[model samples]
Target: MPLNSYQHPCPGGYQIQAADMLIGGTLGARVNWGDPARDVVITAGHLVNNLNAAVFQPGAGVPGENQRIGHVAGRSPLRTYPSSREFLGTRAETPGQRITCRYDFAYIEVAGDSAATSYRIPGINDTDEPLAVRDPIEGEPVHWLGNTTGIVLGGHVRDLSYWMTMELDPTNAANRQYLSVQPLTLIEVQGTMPTRGGDSGAAVVAVNDRHIVGVHCLGGTTRKGRPFTMASRVPASPQALAEGSSSAGFDEVLTWIARTKAWVNS
Candidate 1:
């Protein structure tokens, strides 16, 4: 609970350890699966889902060297998607509803040179301009950079189509570890800015454009306990919104990290 650097608007916004509870998000774009110069750090499989736990950029009391940013090389498996009819034409507006699209996400793997620490996702600007990926339009106009809501500029997209998240599985037992409503191809932003619960894996761009149209995960108040008001509510107002998981769900985690990268490089 110590944030600085203007609430971590850079260096990918981190903090990890879900078993003992310390979660925040964002830290994307630095890919390359099998050594085209090696780099890897995208996030959000419920914020690193305990791959032994240690990621901390600008996190854990705001310092340096808590900077352990790597390890969990891949995650995203708890499937359940059926927005009724089209898991095969590859979706076309088929929100017939069945729920459980949990490709939450995760990709750590940076072990030397700390993945070079910058790919311009911090409040959006360092200028290599590459990070592209799309699909999220229903109102469009989104932006993000969060440790707990630091650069959320305008955020609008009401629903790119299909959503039903609930997620929170600290290994089940806290009442069977929730992932309840389930179906999410989500892009759902809404603004007046103030995302909470460590802003789980923020990235969401597309306001001025870096292309990326999703990553930030889960925010609430659509009637469950009543307290979610993005200004006057109605980005599609079921009540409150702020979700993400579509860069087309990171192309199936980059095709399962390029088909296991030779068992992660043997």
Candidate 2:
């Protein structure tokens, strides 16, 4: 489903549009599938912590431009506390219980209608595969499918690490949380494809097999001034599934969409 400049293999996947009512900004990444009843879209806890509304777009380009598929709500509250250090007097942290930096992940329920359209990797028939820890070998070419440079593709895996840091909240040092120590991977390209502002929550999948290994969580320059991309691994453990409920926000979003679809059909 290639359209315009959006050339990713999974063009139909959901893109997380940050606080912008419109699609076109660096937001969070859409990761994790909580269960069949609720489709979990993982993102930075801070993104949805103070947001008024969160919707899922099945297609690329713009947020509201496509079909209104799903809705999302902040699962937990943001934790703000004071720091002992003089330079950083106040520190705000998201509690792990309420979706904190330890995981740096939040789950959003996908509406019914939208679920059918959201991109799914070819091999992901069930959540049995251990996605949290992928054994991707070094030099194995990988690609990222997201709203990169305006929604195109053709990037390669630059490197893999147990952990890395990206600028989440620039103003507050406390806002920055150590990215969960998972098998985090990076994708790089020359001259840029089409990744632009509003492609934050895109998925980074393996090209050949099309199995989702990571979610595009953040992007920025390296310490040496080189450009790079980053993504968080999806926890494959059942514990991740047991922690959150899928009935409330996620189910409600899907129920509303189903009702709308029925109304339109009538």
Predictions in order: lDDT: 0.46, 0.41
lDDT string, candidate 1, 1-266, tens digits: 32333322235543343332454555644444322334666656666655645555654444553455556655554433322222222433343322233346566666753644555665564564446555556576766665655554445664343333344643444343433222333333454334666666665666765666556666643432332212111111101122322233334433433533432233
What are the runs in model 1 whose C-alpha is more than 4 Å off?
Answer: 1-9, 13-24, 27-119, 122-124, 127-135, 138-159, 173-175, 179-200, 211-214, 218-266
Candidate 2 lDDT tens digits, 137-171: 54455555443444335456755643333344445
Candidate 2: which stretches are off by over 4 Å? 1-46, 50-67, 73-102, 120-137, 169-183, 190-197, 222-226, 241-266
Superposed Cα deviation of residue 18, candidate 1 (Å): 9.0
Query: Which candidate has the top score in TM-score?
Result: 2
The local lDDT score (0 to 100) that residue 194 gets in candidate 2 is 37
Clashes of 2: 14
lDDT of 1 at 264: 24
Instruction: Enumerate clash totals for all models, in the order shown.
Output: 7, 14
